[model samples]
Target: MPAVTADTLTLPRLPDLPQTATAWRPVREVVRAREFLEGEGFRVRRPFPGVGLANADPFLLLDHMGAVEYGPGEAKGAPWHPHRGFETVTYMIDGALEHRDSAGGGGLITDGGTQWMTAGSGVLHSELPPQDVVARGGLFHGVQLWVNLPRAEKWTPPRYQDIAARDTTLLSSGDGGALVRLVAGDVAGFRGPGATRTPITYLHATLSPGARLDLPWPEDFTAMVYVLAGRGTVGPERRPLDEGHLAVLGRGGALTAHAATPWDVLVLGGLPLNEPVARYGPFVMNTRAEIIQAIEDHQAGRLGRTQVPHVTAADEELS
Candidate 1:
């Protein structure tokens, strides 16, 4: 279980949906996460950027870190690097990660906490396991998501949002069978603490066996759900889904899902930016020329300066 949890029976509840009142989003396709080695050679499960990302406009990538227990001196993390043209949201479900950036936005994000960094223009940053984690070793699990900014906001000023786990809005299902943690955006008139420039809904939900969740989602957003643990089904069609699987949903006014076992999942959706994307290394931009410009800017030290460990060609592909 994650460190942050609440008794559902004691929380406010979401309104129940009338059986015929709303259109439930249909499951369009499903994809499983593939193993990928990331920062400092730590393993991660990546579901997009290769699978069904065309529908993930405004969202660039999703990387799921482990729930693995680490032996002493076995934990690892991302070293110093740079990013631009988007935002990075890191959520710690079961451990800790420390962040520092040239933009002066960073802190230690612990269990159930989140770090939201807008790498507008550019910023040099580093993400590392706190010395204690590296020294004592413990269970570490988390997620990092790259959210693409609209072209208009790509050049906006850089910033950060440090949302503590307690700041997240907690709500229960109409029947009290499910617990929903709202990290960003709105739900049934309840708002999450993290303020985002683009319209989006980010949620982590836990359901008891046989429990169902019907969410009021924005009709204009592209939506999907990713299973973090256990077994479940998505959509009214009851498509089979489980750990490491991502189900893309077609447009609709709401989303419906059910848990076949104790289940944990991430439900997210965002307005599509619908713009051209040119990406290379750590930069994502509108055109190939812009990508080159970003590289040149970094070389010129316009993005910022920080001592970085040597990164090989393959490692640079982590963009």
Candidate 2:
């Protein structure tokens, strides 16, 4: 739905970095810290939490979930889980989450809410943790992204789109920055709402101190930038990312983001399933005999939801 217009920034050409010297190493820095997601008896934390896929062809995942501080009528969660062919995006900031799934779909996100699940072909979800947001302590934080489903829509079926917050579509600049284009397509000129089966693109920036932004990506798609708050400067080789960093950008142009004291980022990207993936566990098939027939259809249960648990080591594994 390309109607974006506000000082337009061009983009549309990527996939060529591969010849040597770390493939020209343009911008492949990933530095994360501040990782914490405790609840349900926090004592160094750990509860269905996850943070895997720091890098994978085209971009596979990136989960840095929770910011913690729950309490009253608690709801720490992560129950029924299962996915196929990929596509899950949840972005909140400052408490609240209660998504349900199995197709009927459920909801309850807060602070700039944006859920966007697309477990193409299969889906059985749960991400509860909201009872007035840990009983009023406030600040739970969020960020969950996993995209890669293009083998002709990888199975094709399960879908969702919760995007709230006045239907997301804001853009501002000059000091106290602002940007929220919650899904594939449009920015600067503002034109984002929800519609991402895989031509992905999502933003939710906020900068103040020193403000500066130019972000506009889609050069064949496969971008990245996840620094949720403070610390910036990212393109033109500005470098110096901070706040749970992850700035992997190689193609395209126009990405400046320079905040240093007041920042919040999320500029994602898409269009890179290039083919052959074959992941197991939660199924991301593309081969391997369709991930062994999706693990024999969830172990012959026919995967209808009701039982899909059994993943532990204290559970918090993500690759």
Number of the predicted model whose lDDT against the real structure is largest = 1
Evaluate model 2: give its TM-score: 0.34
Q: TM-score winner among the candidates?
A: 1
193-312 per-residue lDDT for model 2 (tens digits): 767656766777666678676655556776677776578777665788877777777765445556767777777766776687878757787899888887788777565453223221
Pairs of residues at least 3 apart in sequence or in different chains that clash in candidate 2: 13-219, 95-140, 229-263, 230-263
lDDT tens per residue, model 1, 1-319: 6747999999999989976778989999998888899989999998988844544877888999997899999999988887889889898999899998875557898988888887878888899999989999999999898888888988877777777888788999887899999998898899887767777889899999999898888889988999999999999899989999999999888898899999999998899888898888689889998898899898888895432232221232342
Q: Candidate 2 overall Cα lDDT vs. reference?
A: 0.61
- Total backbone collisions for each predicted model: 0, 4
lDDT of each: 0.86, 0.61
Question: Local error of candidate 2 at 280, Å?
Answer: 25
With candidate 1 superimposed using the best TM-score fit, by how many Å does residue 61's alpha carbon deviate from the native?
0.2
Q: Which residue pairs does candidate 1 place in steric collision?
A: none
Q: What ranges in model 2 sit over 4 Å off?
A: 1-85, 89-120, 124-126, 132-134, 150-153, 156-221, 239-248, 252-259, 262-271, 274-310, 313-319
